[model samples]
Target: MSRLPTRTDTPPAKPDPADKRAAWADAAKGVCIILVVLWHVVVKDYLQIDWHIGVPVPGLWGALGEQFLPLRMPLFFTISGVFAANAVLRPWRVVARSRVAGFLYLYALWLLIHTAILALAPDLPTDRATSLLGLLEQLTITPSNLWYLYALALYFTIAKTVRRVPRALVLVPAAALSAVAAAGLLDTPGNRAGLYQNLVFFLAGLHLRPQIERWAATANRRRLVLTAGAYVLALAAMAVAGAQRWFGVWPLVSVVAVAFGVTAAARLGRWPALGDRLATLGRITLPIYVIHMPVLALLHRLLHAPVSGLDGVGQGLIVLGYPILLTGLVIGVSLALHRGLLAVHARWLFALPTSRRPAPRHVAAAR
Candidate 1:
């Protein structure tokens, strides 16, 4: 196995201080986080409940959500992979202490918190193991929303191990494997299958960091036009494939969508007001991601039932508008919970006690 960087090994150059690369990355992450939250709220909670309660489900939001599903989580892992590029070049101790430990802490913490909540409220939709052995088994083999955290730890470890390999050697095989996995060639369970499906994008982000950064920096109009055109073509192809039941084509379509989505986000980051707001949201994405699910779950319990005397359009409006409202509420409450409650009262909600650090200088500017 490849070992981590040592004293003799030169560290990767720090990200350019003058470059707006991190800002664009943050903006991308911000957009992704919102989509994730909305996907869960609209698709998982609202749509399912609407179907269960015999309400006429609106096609608009559901269609839009499905269209972006592939890009959403893939963008997240890609951005994370980019950041992990920096981590893999650090000393082994730093990598272990900072990256591995931090992710594990949050994963374990939230897992237990969610597990406890499920155990206490057996009436909720979430299922829990009744016996201690069963609980341990679940904990070992299963992770709910916190699977992202688990995958992050695994990805970091793998990235470090392969740091010495030629980028093409690793990336090409990974991409092929991801395509196969996405096409249902991987026989793993859902969560594990997700890990396999996303692995290529993560590796691509890590290996292609230099090229990606260059892409972000340049103002290449031709490249933008080409990317947009390709994305449109891919979208059409995906729609045709879906209608024809050609599931195998989806993996490639997903890759194209991700590329276009990331580039678009970078372009959008050039807008002053939007970029600034997105960067701020991106900075706090961790807290929002960690806490929003529980908030949404609670909101679901309260809001799942359909109201009487509303027409299909009115119900559709409520179905659409309510989730956005819940999303905003989750974001706002999560921010307050992190800053007010967690920051002072219980910092361990999102971090290990010892892992806490002072805010970065650019944090203020991002806000």
Candidate 2:
């Protein structure tokens, strides 16, 4: 004991607020991506079939997806805004090349990929550009289900352009646009409705970055529970009053849901294992989001016979388990495809090719 040198253990370092905020955003993104894939699985795969089961699979799952309408895309756009908060401040050309160009390149590339794959699975029940004009329409005037890419390209441009404008001037009109779109006063065909309704959220995330970061940094179990309760009560009130579609109602509901989402995600980040998994998914959401629909479409066609044969067997379990299993499968297959593509040096499918070869994971994943 006397001969042995005394040693002292160092105390563990406290988690940094910045790291916490990043993890919180990643976890929130993870939740959003899963919901996106699940929505597609339900609508495009589950509801597309004639299960012929006694259970009201379509109605029940449809209603569930509808309830999540306020949360999914709004939180997604908001988180995107938060990530691009600094990018907008960079030189215009840089933002153009990195954000605008990157998004548009992916949009055009995937538009073709989706069109080609979806053409073969025409009976799988998804919207796609059928002709050259339809492709042009999707490219210019209207966007397809892959509109998120188009929206991001446009949003980044708008955000960077208006970064010098008064926040109220920019946000008020964006909010009005959302209200009108939500109220069905605007004609937002295809996924244009999402493109229109979510700009306010993205702008809010960009404009209110400090507040959002502060909220995430200070989020706790108590605050999360309280915020979630308020969100539920608000939803209940809206439902009771039949104002879910009122001009301002949807945006308000979406805001509350975003609050709850952020708080819940922040709290989730405090946990080590699960948070890490979610954060990892969050970082790679672009591949899952872009590729899931096509994967699901293909799977639906390939598995049609098998899935249909299960119609009468364990109807109850199939009702709930089918969508969940399909969602997991779509996500898994898409991720595997992404890795496989990278393994073959086909990274350009996900990112813009540069003169100097880009990194294997060069895709802009902020969205």
Give per-residue CA lDDT, model 1, range 132-217, as digits (tens). Answer: 76556545665556678877777788788899999888887777767777667667653666677777878878889888777777
Position 18, candidate 2: lDDT: 56
Q: Against the unseen true structure, what C-alpha lDDT does each candidate score?
A: 0.68, 0.83
> Cα lDDT of model 2 overall?
0.83
Best by lDDT: 2
What is the lDDT, from 0 to 100, of the residue 280 in candidate 1? 64
Every model's TM-score? 0.82, 0.90
- lDDT string, candidate 2, 76-101, tens digits: 89999998888898999888887888
- Deviation in Å, model 1, residue 250 alpha carbon: 3.6
C-alpha RMSD of candidate 2 = 9.6
Displacement of the residue 309 alpha carbon in candidate 2, Å: 3.1
